[model samples]
Target: RFMDSAKRLPNKPMVVFEGQEWTFAQMHEWSNHLAHFWIAQGIGHGDIVCQMLENSPDFIANWIALMKIGATAAFINFRLPPKALAHCLRIATARTLVFHPAFAATVDAVRADLGAATDTAPACPPWATLVDGAVWRVHPATPPPPSRTAAVDFADPAMLIYTSGTTGLPKAAIVSHMRMTLAAVGFPGMYGVSESDIIHCTLPLYHASAALIGFAQACFLGSTVVLSRRFSVSRFWAEVRESRATVVQYIGELCRYLLQASASAAAAATTDHRVRIAIGSGLRPDIWEAFKRQCGIPEIGEFYASTEGTAYLFHWHRAGAPGAGAVGYFGPLARVMNGIKVLRVDPDTHEMVVDSQTGYGQVAAPGEPGEMISRITNEPHKRFNGYFGDASASEKKVLANVFSDGDRWFRTGDLISVSADGYYYFHDRLGDTFRWKGENVSTTEVQEAFEGMPGLVEANVYGVALPGTDGRAGCAALQWAPGHPPPDADARRQLAATLRQRLPPYAVPVFLRYVPQLEHTATLKQTKVALRHQGADPRVCADPLFVYDAGARTYVPLSAERYVAL
Candidate 1:
């Protein structure tokens, strides 16, 4: 599909990045060269190759090259610590590790651990090397033999995109060529986006939203994409303007950041951009109008989806429309055809409300909040590709006998409601994960990271709602050991530093609460209800609260004044 598109529009601009543009023909030629180089290095069909790189034209080209040889590229999250990075590589059973110069230190930090193969996976091949400018410079600009990719099947794994899917560590979701092809054709047709539309993407290319949804769709539509190294509040509108992007892709947090930064010179820069439609997920209702009006963008296209799940919903917002802030709308016909259900679930335990005798879930009525689930089927469109190497993990998302005997449904792990008018509203995440900085922060993962901390005996992590933020902020309630004292100024600073080194930046707790004891459920499990309700508010919580001061590199007591300032 990509080769045919490139051949048909050889001179069309496919990607624009850092003032450099690559046409379809140029990108194809470069990818061909990369394919030949990797083939020579012994990379073959079905080989798992890992990637750690920032958003760049070469990043996309490298992925294309891997596809040309029928190899699966596992895109590692660059924000992860060395431990998490190693875990991802091991899970993917990657044979080669490829990274850009910017991530050389990160790769080196995990190099020793990756040297030997484990019981479950093989060692990295010795020929696996860094992809520097020198490699591309030395390789001949020629395509590999056609037989290299001829045996590739549509169901073959194309990419391994890691997602923190309501669980403790990141899981590599298997994105098949079939899934990619569907998304490439499905999204553009849904949005009515055409070849003339220029999509501006600031999200990380490692993320499915940017890779499968943004770049793949643009490639399929024969549209141009303006890529950025990272999202910049000040430079965002300028890039969109300069590139004349008709559609700008975003996650909810990016929109909030833009709105927050608009108080400065960025306010003036938001207007007059060529952006007509802003499309992405997590646009909060609180700031939807403000973002569209203040930024001078005419439309907001909000979608609700998961990296590994098959359930998808889209909403195209227009002024005075009923679907302004809703995640999506389920038309009657579409709903029936899709066979999706909203089943009642216990909000506290996140368990489905099922009949004791029949063991079937009770379906929620319209306007009632419930967990949205789709039937698990073998159909190409609705099939669940699941995690790459963990069948048990994948099976956990499938509920047995959902509505009837021997029936199964894919649990979305989201609480949602559909109004009488068919507008669907997002309620809450059903499990131990919450959205922070456009990424899923797993509470269980954060708690596990805090387990061996010197003085901490008990830790409860949860998301706290904050003013002026689209998603929740991470907060951890800590109870010290009997003999250990509470964290002092220096201890707090060192603890913050340790957390920053052990976890991803976004996963680190933004607020800390020192408590004498933690509440528990009747089942003896720790409960976060009280702590989450109190949040990080100093006025409400009896326990001492400290907020992370990123600029100061430590934690400071969150007094009423400090809380108000935040």
Candidate 2:
């Protein structure tokens, strides 16, 4: 693949990372260097290397190195809190980690916690630490290809990725090499990516949307990639203009943020002649048209791909119409299920939901919202990388013995509806995750902020009811340990400062509830259900509750009149 692209279009730009440029030759060399780094360390086939860095040139280099060696790579999100991050690294059982040097403190915090992999992960941090290590020495020479004697089939497990568990513990998804290779080719062809295209990659490397699949598509087409340290709405168009990029890899919320940025209009106007395509997922119906208008983009290639299941959907037919239905391209098995499949039981007997003319409750209609269940026929290119064998958790999302007596399928904890024309439409999503301003707002991330505030010891963050809202509004409930200081004005200031720096504004809790105590589950879990009911109720407690004050740009005491518009 590299030789064909290199020979056919050797001079075309391949990658621009940080401030450095990597043409086809350079990127190929870098990938080879990383592969050599792996071999010198004796990390060969069947080994897993954990990646905890954001999307950067190094991240891609390391990932490509693993791919070349036939080793598995587990990409872990860098935004995870210390505890959550440690838990994932433990499961990865990776012998090496390539990360950013800036996160030294975070890495150090969990260094001792990594039980088995401690020896696997060098005590040295990334970049600054590894740059001087003896491992940096040039390899004697690229070793000869390993013998086929080991039976390293493409069907072997090559990657183990976990879902972005916004609710509880994240479940791991195991994907095979064959499935991934097919997926890689599926994306570029589905989206019409070609050697001439220069794609922008701003999403985090750890995410499935950005690194795993996005990078795959770029390489598959032998297209050039432009990388950024992080997603910066202000700098998006500037970079696009700079690189003369033809396409951008995006997740819908990133587009929304670009639309929301103060300079969106001006920046977009500045680049009237550049950027023709956008390929990504999560573009919502409400903001679809406005997003296209503001960005001056003509074509949108969106795909819906689940981590485990082989099925996916892409939107390729309509150049101007982006993200209004199921993904239309990217792979063959990815298809839209026809109707709402529900079950029926006798009203008195109440055995199950009756499958009559209604054919089990499938939302309002094909166009209306309904449960989206995908068939698991176990196609060759498609495999069910079940949730690491989490039987109950996996079962919870699947509706068994439906439609037919003995058929089993995966039930996306999401509610989707297919149109009369067989186009799938967005309904409601039924899971711990809820979309806010187009971004997946993790409650765990929100609550973790208050856990370390000087005035607080524990916090319970969850979504609350709001009129004319999609899922819920963010609310944080807090309790002060006796010795800790109370949440006063200064503490509120500190709280606000920390959140804005660590999290996006939308993910920040809108309402804060302070109570003498909090409700708990039998396992002593903070029962957010009761708190969710209490909402921003000023009467929930006499202590204090904080609601974001739009006018003041800071949270203020909650009041009855204040919630009128809520």
Candidate 3:
């Protein structure tokens, strides 16, 4: 696809980074040079090569070179610590590790953990032997020698993308050539974008969103892609304006941060840009319409998917009528063809509700929130490749005999509800919903009530353990916008009153803590594992903490004495 695009539009810009630009022909030639250089270094066909670099031109060029040589590129997350970095290379068993000079310290820190290079194959290859990516750019720009080996099959592994590892060590997910090709075709067809469009990508290159959804589509359509080394809220509009990007990729938090920064001088171009559409996942319903209206973007393509899962859901939000903030809308044909099934389950234990007669999981009623599952089959489009090196870890996501004998389904680990009209709404993750007072409390729904609150920028809701309590108690970590005053007694009272009006009594947050900013993963999703463990301990947390007084109907400072009394 890239070769064809380069031949048809040699002068067209393929990648724009900072002030530098590379045309299709230029990048193609550079990739060929790198491919030949690697082949000369004994990196033959079907070899596994580990890559750790930030979002840059070299990253794109290196990925293309790997594809040309029919090698599987193991994309390592650069943000990981030294321990996790070593684990990635060990799991991949790559013959060579190529990285940017900026990460030389990180590589040095993990050198002792990586085994030495040896002729005899061991548990792990010699990842300690590093190759500088800068050296490949100076290689002669020419086409690589034609291979006498057989061509790579469609189902063969093309890349290994690591999961976010929210719970434990990140596992590499195998992405086949067919899957990558489908992603390139599916995103553009769904968004109705063409080669005339210029796409802007600021997400990490190792992520599937930027690599497959952003660059792959550009390669297929011969579209220009503006790449950013990293996402900067202050320089976002300038970059978009300079590149004249028509479409931008984002996660929900990036959109929220942009909206919050709209009032600052840096965001003067918030409503004035060439961008016509914004695409990605995790856009909250409360801010969906507001982001579009405030940013002057006409369309939002919010999708629901995962790195390893086969199921996908899409919502093309435009001219917003506020349709329950659904993640996807399925017509009659899609409803039947997609094979999406929602099954009732215990919110706390995550156990399926089985029918006595059939001994199969019961289907969720209309408008009932439950785990979404997709049927597994041998069809090319419905296949699940699972994790790369661990079969047991991959088997954990498969549920057998879900609805009938010998039937298998892929567990999504997400709670979703489908309206009678076929619109699908995301509720929360399976473990994110906690039981309070014998009733299920949705952190997402509770957090949504905090929207539009004066001085509050964002809220991260979670459940915390309390002594003498039957289950976890509701807690919210709040972050105020820049220059906004922290929550005072009056503000706490107002918050309590509003939450009581918007949520049930049991669902109201029992505690609140103010922070400068919330901790997030590389993709900008808020993480609550550490916050949950800390709970309301004033000794452990220096941030301003407050606890609700049920009788007073307001919140007061949570001192160590107050915590002990509770």
TM-score of each: 0.77, 0.71, 0.94
Best by lDDT: 3
lDDT, model 1: 0.82
Give per-residue CA lDDT, model 3, range 1-566, as digits (tens).
88899999999999999889999999999888888788877886788999998998888888888888888899998889877788888989898888776776787788768863533222323443434445566666876655712577778788999988766678999988888998889988998888999999999989899999899887888999999999999888888988899999999889888887775544447877888889898888888887887887899888888877878898888784456368888887888789788889877789788899989999898899999998888776678899988999899999888888898888899999988888889999887888889999999999989987888888999999988878888999999978988867898899899999999999999889998988877787678888999998898889999998999999989999999898
The C-alpha RMSD of each candidate to the native structure, in angstroms, is 11.5, 10.1, 3.5
**Pairwise TM-score winner, candidates 2 and 3:** 3
For all candidates in order, the CA lDDT equals 0.82, 0.64, 0.85
Candidate 1 regions exceeding 4 Å error are 116-130, 137-140, 165-167, 265-267, 356-358, 432-566
Please write out the lDDT profile of model 2 over residues 174-195, one tens digit for every residue. 7777676777787787777776
Cα lDDT of model 1 by residue, 1-566, tens digit: 77887989899999999998899999988898888778877898999889888899988999999999999999987777778788898899988877776676777778778784322212333433445556665776767678989999998999999884223567899999989998889888877788999999998898888998889987778899999998888788989989999999988767866876674554558878888888888776767888898898888888888877878888988777777779998788988887688889875557899888877889889888789998878877678888989999899889887778888788998888888888988765676567789876767568757745776766889999999987889999998878888989999999999899878999899999999887642112356766777899988888899999999889989999999888
Q: For residue 295, what is the lDDT in candidate 3?
A: 82
Q: What's the TM for model 2?
A: 0.71
Lowest-scoring 10 consecutive residues by lDDT in candidate 1?
Answer: 118-127
- The best candidate by TM-score is 3
Rank the candidate models, highest lDDT first. 3, 1, 2
